[model samples]
Target: MSADLGWWGVPLAILAGTLRGSAPFLFVSLGECLTEKSGKINLGLEGSLLMGAMSAYAISYLTGSPWTGVIVAGIAGMALGGIHGWLAQQPRVNDVAVGIAMIIFGSGLAFFLGKPFIQPVAPQLPSIAFGSWSSSPQLESALRVSPLFILGVLIAPLMQWFFRSTRWGLLVRAVGDSPDAARAMGISIFKVRLLSIMVGSALAGVGGAFLSLYYPGSWTERISSGQGLMAVALVIFARWNPMQCLYASLLFGGAQAIGPALQSVGVDAYYYLFNASPYILTLLIMIITCSPKRTLTGVPGALGQTQE
Candidate 1:
């Protein structure tokens, strides 16, 4: 029994790590879930997320209020999403290419704006007290999970329920599966997609704010750490389901924490590979879940059409 209990500890430790590590991925996954469900892909999520991180820190540092930064970050994200949506509505613009371009622009923008913020310690987010539950340092450390993690978990179920049970969700589904048919049914497909993109961007902005206010409050080029790109792939892995994204993001998080664990144990050889784990997993999940046939059949029919 003692041995069995000791073995059980490993999973519990991983679970804690998963909760801590997956919080960011969860935000990105949730945002992507909203975007994809509306039948449009917002690849610029990387740029939006980074810009949010930079913007949040800068705003909070100046104002001394973390909440203010969070709000501004959301607005910035909405702006990015709106721009992407607006451009996508144009006849000649390619969404994929536009996303890549935004990534470059966002990167430059963050660096340019974050120059002054690199040294200052920005405002910190308030945390839930997991510390009260235990005395052992290990246990206490494990308990220090982010509130955002909890929120992300809660969001998954709520989003799932909303989409399956609400009128607005039905409209979103209508837009994704068949815009023409939805139009025939009196739903405005363009309006649904536009709304979804804005919502998705706002969520993605929140995800970026999570980085600045929570985990690592310092601004750097690598803060977002390619999380945006991988999250784009996570949408496919989650199969258009927000609830599934919660689980999938946690799985990716667990995988990500492995290398750090190794480094702690004095094994440094696998660090780079561990750093790459999330993207690798994201890519694999995409390949496994994406079916060319099914995408054509199930995806929003008006995906590439001009929204005029």
Candidate 2:
């Protein structure tokens, strides 16, 4: 039930908005963080996310299980990353160009596969109920968030530890910063990048699945138009640290929720502009966080490399 939340209920609304908005980015940023950590940027994440959305929705509808759909979507995204890695390992096509091509292919593929399932309702994820603690109806509704949101929150710190403390994490950083150096030290740049992309793509796919099987339900040609793109930017803003990605993603998520929250409270004069707030905030965060000075600390050194 929607809360009778009045003007003072802004905090509750923001809380609700943060959960709703952040789930998608949580998935995408986590994925991009891995890819960038390996010193490669997979702009094709857009395609991967869209493809995952379609694949997840179709599978969920067919199988009557959202979790199963999520798994299949992740596999599809990894396959896409595998193709990107193989092509990138070749000299003929640039990674950027391949990524762009992948975007087109992914979008088209999502559209094509998604056509038949557009109207079919698929199995959706159940929300976590933390409402028992609250006595007020408004409070209960406010707490109706999902377990996946909590899952995303937990992944962030785990990623930070993996990056800062693990042997593989050091290897990933070493490869990103100096492939030649890493090569001399017995690390494989190609393998690292390939694995990173696959992991990132898989997360992106899961993120897409969240959109269709949880937040909105069902699917469409443009269900994930720019969410994937913004998430890549979020990874940069978070500086390749998974813990930071969590906070940054939630903030972006809050910005998106603001537009709707305002509209819901009978404020619509600037609703259209509110719709664009999230993207604008994303741009601003990237511009501020990606300055050369900040990037040195947060950005991967191995990004956009040319093998010699």
Evaluate model 2: give its lDDT. 0.82
Each prediction's RMSD over C-alphas, in Å, is 3.9, 2.2
Q: Score residue 68 of candidate 1 by CA lDDT.
A: 90
Model 2 superposed RMSD (Cα):
2.2
lDDT against true structure, model 1: 0.77
Q: Measured by C-alpha RMSD in angstroms, how accurate is candidate 1?
A: 3.9
Which residues of candidate 2, in runs, are more than 4 Å off?
A: 1-3, 280-295
| Reference-based TM-score of each model | 0.87, 0.92
lDDT, candidate 2, 235-279, per-residue tens:
767767898889888888778777777887788798888878877
